[model samples]
Target chain A: MSPRLFRSRPARVVPAVIVAIVILAIAAALGWVAIAAIATGGSGDSALSSGFSGFASLGAMTWGAPPVITAAVIIALLGLILLVIGISPGAKRNIGYRTEAPEHIERFEVILPTSALASLAAAAADSVDGVSSVRAASNASSTIVTFSTPVRDNDGIRRDVDAAVTQRFASIAFNRTPTVKVRVQRRQA
Target chain B: MRRMAAGANRTGLIIVGLISLGAGFAALAISFGLAATAAPGLSPDAQLQPIAAVFALPFSAGIALVAALILAMIGVRWLAVQVPRKDSAKPLRMQEDSRSGVTTVTANVVAAAVEDDLEATPEVVDAQAILRGTARRPELILHVDVDERADFDTVVADIAERVACNCSQALGVPLSAVGVEIGIARSRQRRQRSVQL
Candidate 1:
């Protein structure tokens, strides 16, 4: 197996499950109608024959009938929605890291989720000497670190927090280094 | 992470979508009298008796039953694939020559050993591993949770150099591929107790 450097997209499980259920339901209905028709020997009053008779009533409706047009429109829209879901790639769930290994051996690919990256950034920022508390959020492209301190001299503390978070991210060697943004808030001691 | 039936889902969606789109468009076309040229009596106001009359045929019930069975099979297959799969390799035959003796190792056994080794690493709170590929070209995939403040680079390097080398040496074959997924552990609840004073 080769290394997979790219992030994996989420499987469209919900849509797939729904579609499968719909198919099963349709199959069940078809089976029921077929059985009813077979048992009744295709009599006019049989469920399947009656079902068709009911459908034949729709022939009385003009092409411009509200119900006919609405059903057609709804079916078309449902198909369009399914097509879109099938084509669209879902959200990426992890960020790949650059691998560093000896040339003779296969390099190990590393990955981290955005939530984990954010936690790492927050931990690094919290460890900064003057930072009393910290919060961080990360995406594929960037991370924002926000820290609150009870110190009046916050400029240096902000820089230190920024450096700490940046160093942590650098050590991970992410394939695409997310830019770090730091914000500091001051509180009375 | 386990493998998903994404390809199957996409294919199913595409097939269903095309059928639905075609049916809807055909209905719309007939409603608008667009199909009048092909079937003269087909119109929005046309009696559906002619269309529904096919079901009244002698063999229509058998055809419907067959179609239902086919649809049911498709539905069951789709539902079955929803279960996640690991797709791990089969038991590895590690013996140099089968004439002398054969040694077989299950993927789970190797994966468990790798997980134990990973958890032994400093600051790694939890670890999971899966071994794939043949014995000659093995692949290892690991997911490890380490303390947020742990040195990320050192831990990664340790896995790449030490853990992988140890596994390769044990198997007597160099790993063809290795994948590590790192996560941050905020809680110390699962941390290993090194010393009990």
Candidate 2:
């Protein structure tokens, strides 16, 4: 079993695969059409040539037709989706860290996944006294801790949660320390 | 795989997307009668004599060439995908003999041994290791799930120290980097449930 499983970015890969498939299909279709046209001595009445004539006749298509409008909308939507994916800022999975040892030591880096960070945050939050339950979510910039309590004194609970989370973050020498946000809410009975 | 796919295909996708978008918008505008200029080349009803006149031997040859190139490009991309990623690190050099040839150990084998040893530890419920990079400068990525009651820091530091020593001493390949990902093991009581009709 390999521990170093490479993470995939669906935002980029899915659209790319779609585009590739579309290109391949078009190329194949055009190739077949070309072959048919050549075999039929460039006859306009040939099946392949007639089929392509439909595409070549697209300019004369009326905007009032249901099918044409639908196609235009679909095509435009697909393009918009692709454009959004291309422009969006991609999320990186690993956290960078530099190892410190003796002088003249070899330089190497370590990466921790966001899942690990979330687990650490959860563990830290769970240990707090008034926190009856804790749910932690972490991203590149911050970790948000949502805790509930049966009793009042939200301020006290918040202070404790902040201290615990801060201490946990301080303990680990992370390359990028995410800001911890604690939300103390009343627990449901 | 997602990372690999994106790295290989993102640029081509953007280009194709842009073209599709532009063509789609152009079609919509033309159909709506917004543009004043006539789309002569697009309509089959037009006098396609000029374009059709050029579609003789040279057009056939060019289209055939383009079709072949497209298929070839797709084939190459497919072939490149078939090659597995470089997962296993460089082989550890063991015994070098005059007659029996050189004996080497694979990184996966060492990783497996380390995983097994770590799993045997009291604090660790499960463990996995992946070795990557050259043997001279290898990286060890460890995923260790600790017992719920176990101290997180203690378990992590213990696993790191032990794995480093074991790999260095046994395989004679000091790790250039070690990444430890700690997870809390789920309780067995919660997992085991009885159902009755």
Candidate 3:
């Protein structure tokens, strides 16, 4: 089975599929009208004669017409949106871990998702003495840990939780260490 | 991770976007009389009859037919690549000499063995592996879920030093690349059958 080891960015499949379908529709319509016109020798009585006449009448509309201007603006806006999607690099998904491989190993990469890192931080903070529970949230560069404790004297517990969580992260040896922030909240009786 | 035509999608979007932008801008330019200097006949007040008359010609149908076919092909190709792919490597020939008996190992078999080996580790709850590249220069990609309370450093060290090393020895070749992704499992679901005294 295949494993999605790293988070991938959006592939813009929706917009691409939409554009493709639109192109297909346009192609079908154009082909139909062209084939009908050719088969009927451009006769006015043909079924597709109205479609041809519609196209011919479009030439009568001035470039300054409101409908034409509105369509041009919409098309331009859509083009801009697609251009941005194609150019943007999206977000980073993985937190890299430092690796020291043996000489025989040519390449080694280790990664952990932000969610897992947060879980690890929460577990570490919870293991500290006087901490009743822990919640953690992490991003690429930082982790925020919140602890709920029954103890009245919060200073010592806060320090201990900070040290424990920081030490836990240090042991993992990430490629870039995320700064740890600790918040202690007193539990209600 | 599953393979996707991300590059193709980006390229297609860019091409389509440029064309749309060009058409829209050209229309706007003509509407605003910006292009009147370049072609007096294409003024903002000018009727589209001159352009529409081209379609009344005999060859216009043939041109439309060719353009329709090209657009249809592009659309079909774009639609086809929307499906995700695994792109796994083929069976590898592990034996050095084909003249004697040959040893062939499928990627799935190697990946399964690696998964089992990873699960045997103390804190690992679940694991998945994919073996890629040639036999002589094999690559291992893994996803491991470990208990939140487990020692992350020890688990990672075990994978690099023991599991990967064992696989390399079994295949009689050094691993060219190894990528391990770690996840945390909040709950332990694996049933313990034996206790270590």
Candidate 4:
């Protein structure tokens, strides 16, 4: 990935929105509760006292009721979802690998997009004999090339495709060379 | 720092949300008579006592302060994450003159020129350059959009070579790092002629 693309992380809009809404709701609730406490002179007379007191209590919680258990489960599930979303590496835009420049060149890096890699791989695989068509998918770690050929020996085509792709990848000075895999199937007559 | 803040933002929000959500649901559940039989002796009025007492004294103010701080923290991180950052470092000296005043240029200016030059290329549709680090040792971030049919490798190499050469000789500064991102431009649709009868 380009350092610029990686360094300039995209804003987590969904998470940010969730956080904003939750925080605002909680802030509003706290404000209301605090106001109610002050309005009632901290007396046990306020209507919200029941909810507030229950929350403030540090004693062991009674978990006998079905409604309480159900509510707890739902809330726990929601929290788990949020935690997963927050902690997990979310969807990332495809940015290609950072490649080393040619020898005797000044310090510079070229980021080749995954699309470009796939294109290059497909082009290389297409050059092999008996390969009717080629489709390739690539990322920073690996490239998978699948081709259809009408030839008798699919295995030979696969090997040829693999070798061609390997050669192409070897020529590029990628920060890390991706493993190449080739799949060949006989084309339908 | 931005990445760290981003991670913290998510963690903090999820943690706080879980606590608040759990408490709210628990209170509602108890009110609805779920597991209400377990605490046969406890009443709705009774639960309020612990909370009221906690918020009655200095603890009330403290809770309020903490709540405000949490809200502020989430809010600030959300805003901070939205702003794009280019790493800042030392400034590069462009010229040194004994009799005349010394001349200097920021990495940003060099990057802008490079961006403009790249965009001027026939194959390139648009480009942006973000300069990072100090003046003497700058890192260039080049993002370019090229004609979809253009030769991807050749265009990238051409842009890199041009930018590196231009910056070194023109700006007289050695770059510490350079990174480029290339995007294929969408094909333009041809317009149809309108006929007036």
Candidate 5:
């Protein structure tokens, strides 16, 4: 492929290429050992010795032009992969959590409770001091809140959510670690 | 250092795991092919032999599969990281309003000192106060809980005098701002927190 494709987005191609190199290395080692053993009439020691010796005397083993070109291509592909991974020192995580909870519950014949997991989560969230308001997702099990006055983006709000979720979900059979999102908002001061 | 650790994140560690897993699978597949070839009965073709299959299978197909599997691992990790960010809500937090050695205080220190000096007045049976208004000036809202037969005006007058004496000599807060009010004539047994202003 073009150099632009790999450079612009290394995440897309690096894993594929790394996997390809691993495949090629295993195939080469197997091919060398098996071919050597057959040529030496099932002698395991001779086959093993020759596999290493072959790489040591790289250009000495005679092969067809097509086979040689294929090997070259494989080697170049492996090199490109190593380069990409080396440059990308670490991984980057984008924000947010997404979970799917049940639609309805049948707790001791109290069927179809319109008041859902998300609604309770919102209520618990509102109880927090710095929290201005909470707004859950359309899916009742999922809750998202607008913090009318945010203390800090992830630190303050994230801690409060963890506590609030534990308190609110304490009573239900809908046992889950509910995802808590804190969005900063402003109220009329 | 903390920022660097955060930046390295979950995705980077996942990539490392994927590469290691890919290498392991490729080795296993190549070894399995080698084992098959060492036994001649499994050979499909005489000339193009079982040995040829061992030599070629790993390079042609097995390596490719391992690479694709590693890419799939990356995708799976990415999905795992996205779920929690979308589900946040209003959370609780705390801040220090003032840091003068106390974690929390429900009473004014200066007002408490003034109430101590109010005890000398004989007619002032009970007294309570609070720092009120926008300036938080100490105001005396005294509750002289009198008996049914006692003079209410006489008791209020004594409490007022006590508050004035304490203000000028002890607290130095203006005596004019110290307004006293007679609350309930109830006993102290049923009362909550009360401070003499």
Candidate 6:
């Protein structure tokens, strides 16, 4: 379940589905209109035969003027309603894909076995194209692998350097993965 | 499941929503029939029709609207639901984040995996392994080159397996954290092979 879905309000769908179900209910009423007329003729021949019997009774309004038309409308509406209800759960499930840990791991660290791997990682990283200089001796835990590439293109250069380092180190095990920070040392375009 | 349906509370709200939806529809049907029947001579003011009468009630349609909204909410209800359960929980997760934090997962996984690798082969004389990961960058690990006489492929396979296992264990952590870096390469002469007899 995606935590993001919770952030979005689901209130918007109801109006649309309700309007749709109502329209469906209305169509359903139309589908049953002929049958309603017939059934009403059979049961309430005195009513429609009497030509739009002018609201003669509350029971007409309470249940339905011609009963079966009401039944038709109700049945169709109920079916549509059930569909909307049934689909709602499935819809939410469809767009949901992310999960967040409730406990929230704020910070953690792992010590590396040696600085040699870090240096090699730095060396291999510096060798990549577009890189201007490697801040191998920075006090920072991450390598400030500066790039000669343009600022706008620094992202691409950084990715390339990162990829190169990843490939170079693919066959070995290290305690920390070098984070290549791309700073544009110089740029032409 | 029943408990889940009600926001992990009693199923009161959902039931209420269900009943209200039904009632609202029933009311709508009745109102439609009344209006359709009274269509001929209904007051020209257009407000006298029973459908109009029902709509005037305000609360009923609102209830139906509420029911409809509730029904819509079901679309995300499952995802929004925070159930404390796991059916197919994998022991490892390899989520890569471009930060030093990812390095920790890589390290843990790589370290744990080294043991697994050692268990598989006989000639690995206490190999040392390193691993690290970052989101802004790809992961890296240093396998401290060891046992000059050992088969390379076997060593590689052992380290890879260890990295993969640790990667899975560290959900959201990358396998690249396990870099087989040879921090020290000392040729320790083979001690007397302990006879297991």
Q: Where does candidate 3 stray beyond 4 Å?
A: A1-10, A28-53, A118-139, A142-171, A179-189, B59-66, B186-197
lDDT of 6 by residue, A146-186 (tens): 44554554667777877866665453333333444544455
Which CAPRI level is candidate 2? incorrect
**In model 5, what is the error at residue A123, expressed in angstroms?**
1.4
Q: Estimate each model's TM-score.
A: 0.82, 0.67, 0.77, 0.61, 0.20, 0.21
Question: Which has the higher TM-score value, candidate number 1 or candidate number 4?
Answer: 1
Candidate 5 lDDT, A1-189, residue by residue in tens: 211101112143434344444554555555555455445544332333333334433333222234443554555455445445545543321111121211111110111112233444555665676766666542323446555654444457657865766655443333233455555565543
- How far in Å is the alpha carbon of B135 misplaced in model 2? 3.8
Docking verdict class for candidate 6: incorrect
**Which ranges in model 4 have alpha carbons more than 4 Å from their true place?**
A1-13, A36-63, A95-98, A102-107, A112-189, B1-5, B10-66, B87-102, B190-197
RMSD of 4: 8.3
Query: lDDT at B105 for candidate 4?
Result: 68
Q: Every model's Cα RMSD, please?
A: 4.6, 6.6, 5.6, 8.3, 26.0, 21.8
lDDT for each residue of candidate 1 in A57-103, tens digit (9 for 90 to 100)? 65456665778778988888888888888888876778887767654
Please give the lDDT score at residue A24 for candidate 1: 90
Encode model 5's per-residue lDDT on B62-137: one tens digit a residue. 3333444554555455434433231111221212353544342233443455455444555445554443321223
Candidate 4 on A11-55: residue-level lDDT in tens? 455666666766766666776665665565554343443335545
Q: Pick the lDDT winner.
A: 3
lDDT of 2 at B140: 68
The local lDDT score (0 to 100) that residue A95 gets in candidate 2 is 61
- lDDT of all predictions: 0.80, 0.63, 0.83, 0.63, 0.39, 0.40
Decoy 5 TM-score against native: 0.20
Docking class of 5: incorrect
Deviation (Å) of B187 in candidate 4: 1.9
The list of candidate 5 runs beyond 4 A from truth reads A1-107, A111-115, A138-141, A150-154, A175-178, A186-188, B1-197
Ten contiguous residues with the weakest lDDT in model 4 chain B: B186-195
Ranking by DockQ: 3, 1, 2, 4, 6, 5
Ten consecutive residues with minimal summed lDDT in candidate 2 chain A?
Answer: A101-110
Off by over 4 Å in 6: A1-146, A149-189, B1-54, B57-59, B65-69, B72-156, B159-197
Per-prediction TM-score, chain B alone: 0.88, 0.64, 0.82, 0.66, 0.31, 0.30
Deviation in Å, model 5, residue B95 alpha carbon:
70
